[model samples]
Target: MPDQHSTLRAQRRAETQRLIQAHAVRLFTERGYDATTVTDVAEAAGVSPMTVYRHFPTKEDLVLIDRHGALVAERIAASPAERPLVGRIGGALIDSVAALTGGGHGDDLTADERFLLARLQLMISTPALRAKHLDNHYALQQAIVDALGDDATDPDAAFHVRAAASACLAALHTALVRWAEDDGRTELPELVTKALAAAFGERIVDTPR
Candidate 1:
């Protein structure tokens, strides 16, 4: 039932994505994200000059985390139909801590996660990654705007829904920065709830370090 050309195209795109990510992760681990060049990735991936550019326009795009957008879309899509957007978004936010930190590490990450967090902290502290992070946030906000518009029938109501969405994401960001300092010993989901509540009202009781 599937169209062969469409299926082939999907396969090609997935392969290209894998190649790009593979090379990018290497350069990121070696010379660091900021110092790594697109040319370096192309050479490492054994692709033509234009092919690399075709997949990722800028070097930052090579490592940008659009996974956040995917998660946001999935979160909203799975929510109850009749719940208010704010409540659903809030619940999704509070529920997403597991998805955020629950995989890949085999044992207590006290050491491994420290190195992993250091990698993330490296990205966060780098100007290039920070710029990419900002770009990612704006793109994510636009997606939230689109999702809000889809869910709200009243033209005037959508704006408020999106504003609440923005607040929720901003709360998540605030909590992540604080969590990063803890080096992943503590759970981020708990911090997310406190941060979301604080963003709305009341002093968020930060879990004791």
Candidate 2:
């Protein structure tokens, strides 16, 4: 019973954190990240400024640390070891996108998904946010390398895994930058799928303009 209660409490805490982040992103998009304040996010989220700080120490964190990246990392870690590493990474990215945006169809996004897309736009367009995102992208690659469980002492394995992770991240970053450039009219999932295919040496029949 105590364990069950603890689980419930943790779940509630996580939900509250998501709520805080979602509201913070919305405010950042609506009012501009520079003009928005933590107090404003707190009020929007119906929490105290201290609580907002507890979840996100800085305004930049509200944009940098996202659940989708963690989910994609977990998917990559869970991929079968026998599979080709780059292909597995690509599949994991698609799976994560489907999970985040309900199949990444882009036909009719849910309210939350729409807001998340908006948040991505804001992050890519804003210089400060873009810098933080690049830092986070490197951190994410390190995380993927760690998840791959390559022996740090084995120079060959370490180099191979690092190279693979770097390429995967590069493809993802390229797709995102292009998507943002097009004003997000193209479905992100489609862009990611195409970019990964090209990265793995598949010929592209249609390129994003």
Candidate 3:
């Protein structure tokens, strides 16, 4: 009974956080990000300032909160261990994009994809957000490295894992940048696969321009 109650509480908390973030994005879009305040987002979410602060410690947190690292890590951990590390990481990245976009493109974007697109646009346009975005990428790289479970006792193996993680994430970042630049007309999963192939010396096929 206690465990069930805790689970329900967690679900409710997640719902509240989602509601607050939705309101924050809408308000940030309506009024420039710089022009909006935590108070404003709280009012838009119909929650108290305290509640907003409890969910998002900083204004940037509202825009920068991301679950990509967890998604990538889970996929990498679940991938066949016999596969090359770079291939596993790269495949995970492409898979993550497919999951996010529902394996579709253009008008078929899922609500999550649309939300991510908006966040990407804001991050690219805002200098502060852009800086934080790089930090987020670094964190993502670390997550991948951790997921691969490189032996800390072997410096060479650890270094190799870190390098592969960084390289794969760079490819993913390039794909995301191009996706944002193209206004999401191209299929994101395709772009990710192509980018990873080029980076990892795999044969590249033409992706929709």
Which one is best on TM-score? 3
TM-score of each: 0.73, 0.86, 0.91
Question: Which is better, 1 or 3, measured by TM-score?
Answer: 3
Q: Please provide, for model 3 over 175-195, each residue's C-alpha lDDT reduced to its tens digit, 9 standing for 90 to 100.
A: 888888777888888888888
lDDT of 1 by residue, 1-209 (tens): 46998999989987887677666766777788767777788889988768877877777677664355666667767776677556667666656544656532334554423444554665676787776677767777776666555665576766677687788789978877776666665666777777877766433222111
Q: Tell me model 2's lDDT, rounded to 2 decimals.
A: 0.75
For every candidate structure, what is the RMSD over all alpha carbons to the true structure, in angstroms?
5.1, 4.0, 3.3
Ranking by TM-score: 3, 2, 1
- The collision pairs in model 1 are none
lDDT of 2 by residue, 1-209 (tens): 99999999999988988899888888888888899999999999999999888888888888777776687778877877777776766677667766776533254666655766777788887889988887787787777677677533388877887787778778888877776566556777778888888887653212221
Least accurate 10 contiguous residues by lDDT in model 2: 200-209
Candidate 1 TM-score, true structure as reference:
0.73
Model 3 CA lDDT for position 164? 83
* Candidate 3: pairs in clash: none
